[model samples]
Target: MPDIKDPLFQPYSLGSLQLPNRVVMPPMTRSRASQPGDVPNALMAEYYAQRASAGLIVSEGTWISPLGKGYAWTPGIHTPAQVAGWRQVTEAVHAACGRIYAQLWHVGRLSHTSLLGGQAPVSSSAIQAEGVNVFVAENDGTPGFVQASRPRALDKAEIRAIVDEYRQASRNAVAAGFDGVELHAANGYLANQFIDSNANDRTDEYGGSLENRLRFLDEVARALVEGVGDASRVGIRLAPLTTLNGCADADPETTYLAAAKLLGEIGVGYLHIAEADWDDAPLMPVAFKERLRTAFPGTLIYAGHYTAERAREAVARGWADLIGFGRPFVANPDLPERLRIGAPLNEHDRATLFGGEARGLIDYPALEAAEA
Candidate 1:
């Protein structure tokens, strides 16, 4: 084959690290973490190591505390066992010469009482996400999902504690041997719930206007930086125009643009935008993307139904610094290599997308193995 000079293969610099390609493995919840303690294990380690060829690996969203969990079998970073469990995962990825970032997450109101010790979910407001649901373990040891419970608005004290939890999680991530950490502020999670006006009805300092709504996000970013002691190792994911998990704002463009500028000023390493991924999902306007490119001075990464051709075009236009592949990385461990060589990709099996063993996680055949 002739030499492939794709921009996706070109090296790029993100903060203090240099990337070999612009392909990123974005955070995807497989719901396969070890049960009982929601700890990372050798299975998760092998799964990530198999896809270490990506320019960057953003680990699945990890709950920072018991209250942060919204799903069954997802990992956490708060406890000693959980930290040690992640140590093995980080070691495995590093052994393969891969760079990985831990995505710190708190699901907030998008949770069930069953998942939260029968306690009401907490959010910026008392409103429950109308149609949102969370995965939980059933009596038979099988995974099942339940609708989110009505949430109580968090007071200032509780909000402060949550910020501290984020800081602690960042410290734990470093101790666990991660290269960096990404704040899960997207997809109507806690941070996004705070950002979206409809979900946040507080009249206090944390609510009312745009600046107030952005306060939580700012505090979390600052806390992560303080914990990691370096803004270069910190990244954040946002969903500006997404209504996923029932998060919607009247003026999404303005709300997110201000946030982009604020994050840029904070000197974060990168800004990841998770565009609506479902089929018939609202398309992210080009004008908004252009504005985002200008507003956020750090490296920009975008994910959502991207193809090789579309990714190439995105980079060619200076729109994205990296293209995150969620499902592609799931089915193609050696996705960057396959893209480079124009090899056929393995189709993802939706049946095994979540809560499975190695059948769909680490067993995807690489091109070399497939040909052999």
Candidate 2:
């Protein structure tokens, strides 16, 4: 059993919601949505319900529109059928006494033409994401990773349209019964394309100055706040130092501190930071983390390759209000309990991590079942 002083098992108040623990199951793309319409389904609902013990569960990245899609078999929140499909997921989670948020995603230049009906992917600039690949179905409908196609820059009008799409998606998420919505501004997606320096080279209002670079994120976050009818129901994810999918800023500290201040000004509920988790990745300076805690007044969550000791240390030190465990939550449905009791965990099957049946999605036994 965990000590009474263990911060990881303590209850937390996230806005109006009371979370039972500080373990966050972050949004991870499983690519397991039903095909044809990219709809959520019963299998996903079961998967989430099994892991509802987390303090919060941010659903797998669901595209806001067809154009927002970057990979095959991932879910979307655009159409009526998609919304209905997600209603089942939310109902299931709620019945299990879990709080869940939908992650709205748009994968800008990190997409292939095949996934977009031969239309070019859109980004802040017309640059090909060299040495990066997006998952897509080939001409024969066989899914595999392919080189990202060259993208065209979005016009100001088109940028506004995408912002509107994000707004509507947030509304759809709420209608589908989610507790709130999270904007996937991290992981080299559409919003990150605008924020990162090397990926954006336009000489327009949406580029050049730091304020201009952060404009898209601001608009989108405001739209989400409006869509949810409250600022406390919206969160934004940001990856300042990660260069995933060829998105990297020349000065991440300055860029992200400014971004954090902007989010604070917008009155969003939380700021979730995705730390670079790759081996030998540049460490995010502790000073920057302190600055971020100052910059954003609401809840702060940090997710990466965090061990139980590291997570407790971060939370106990006030660096993170909550710590997200990604792969740990994959194979351990009772992750919070396992961490509390120091129980052994089931190893995740890497082969079935994406676009498969229930083998890896829901087969992991809970602690009781494992013991039995």
Candidate 3:
């Protein structure tokens, strides 16, 4: 057994999986998938395999369909080539004795016509996310982000079809050999847009009241549950207080608390809360944390700017079962081991954070190599 005194090192049961430690490597979009098809490749597989030391590895946001894609070069699980590519990633991680889950994503209004083949992005409503920009490959062979375009509100039939897309993506993920799946409902993406009243203005059954607003999440969760055939093998991410990608709910506390309750009712294996990682980002309140603990009956994971000390405190206080390290893990593949030995961490290069080659991806030296 791991040292109980070090709450961060102690093992915890996350749904049906028995994690070796409380360290989690949360999803961070590197936007490095192979171009032309946004398919996972050997380079992506190698990157994930190197970081397989985490107790749980949540793969970056992967689009569920072409319509769901918002950024250039981000992987998708909706196609045959993409599924095969992800299979390589999963196999590599598994070979390294790591368990990985694919995060299902749909960006909604956080998209650009340049990236969408000139098609307007789809969302819960026709509202545009003012001042949001999405990264796209420039015609000059350089990467650049352009302003997000106004989105067309998805019709009822289209909404239902998107749920099917999520279901198919879950099936593809399982077939691709992922240990499980995580629905990317956080960070002001598609699901977040539907949940945020400011982003969603509709008089239909899927809009207006809080219950109506939650309808999209409910349907998507249900479809994933049905596809995966086990609630214990599924997770959903939520970010209540974030105003990212032009999404801000009228009453975040109440809206997120209710969302937690609904997700609990749906019986997902775990709930991943994404805290804003920016320095000036507001911290999630203690009261909100307590309420969330009561609202969800499954394992709870917290992400965003968490240090070792804070992660330990959260685990000791029984609030978070696991703590996720994003940028930290980007530069430290063996993060758990480094934390265990209290080694100085390597800094991640911000310039190579987004779309990049191996220079910043799999080239980050491990602690032993750095010492050598």
lDDT by residue (tens digit), candidate 2, 1-372: 335789898888888988889999999889888878899999999999998989999999999998899998999999999999999999999999999999999999888888899899999999889999888877777778989999999999999999999999999999999999999999899999999889889899889999999999999999999999989889999998888888999999999999999999999999999999989998888789999999889999999999888999999999799999999999999998899877887889988888888999999999888889
For model 2, the stretches where C-alpha displacement exceeds 4 angstroms are 1-3
Clashes of each: 0, 0, 0
lDDT of 1 by residue, 125-144 (tens): 99988878788888788877
TM-score of every model versus the real structure: 0.98, 0.98, 0.99
Off by over 4 Å in 3: none
Error of 1 at 102 (Å): 0.2
Q: What Cα-based lDDT does every candidate model obtain? A: 0.92, 0.92, 0.92
Question: In model 1, what lDDT does residue 77 have?
Answer: 98
Error of 3 at 28 (Å): 0.7
For model 1, the superposed segments whose C-alpha errors exceed 4 Å read 1-4
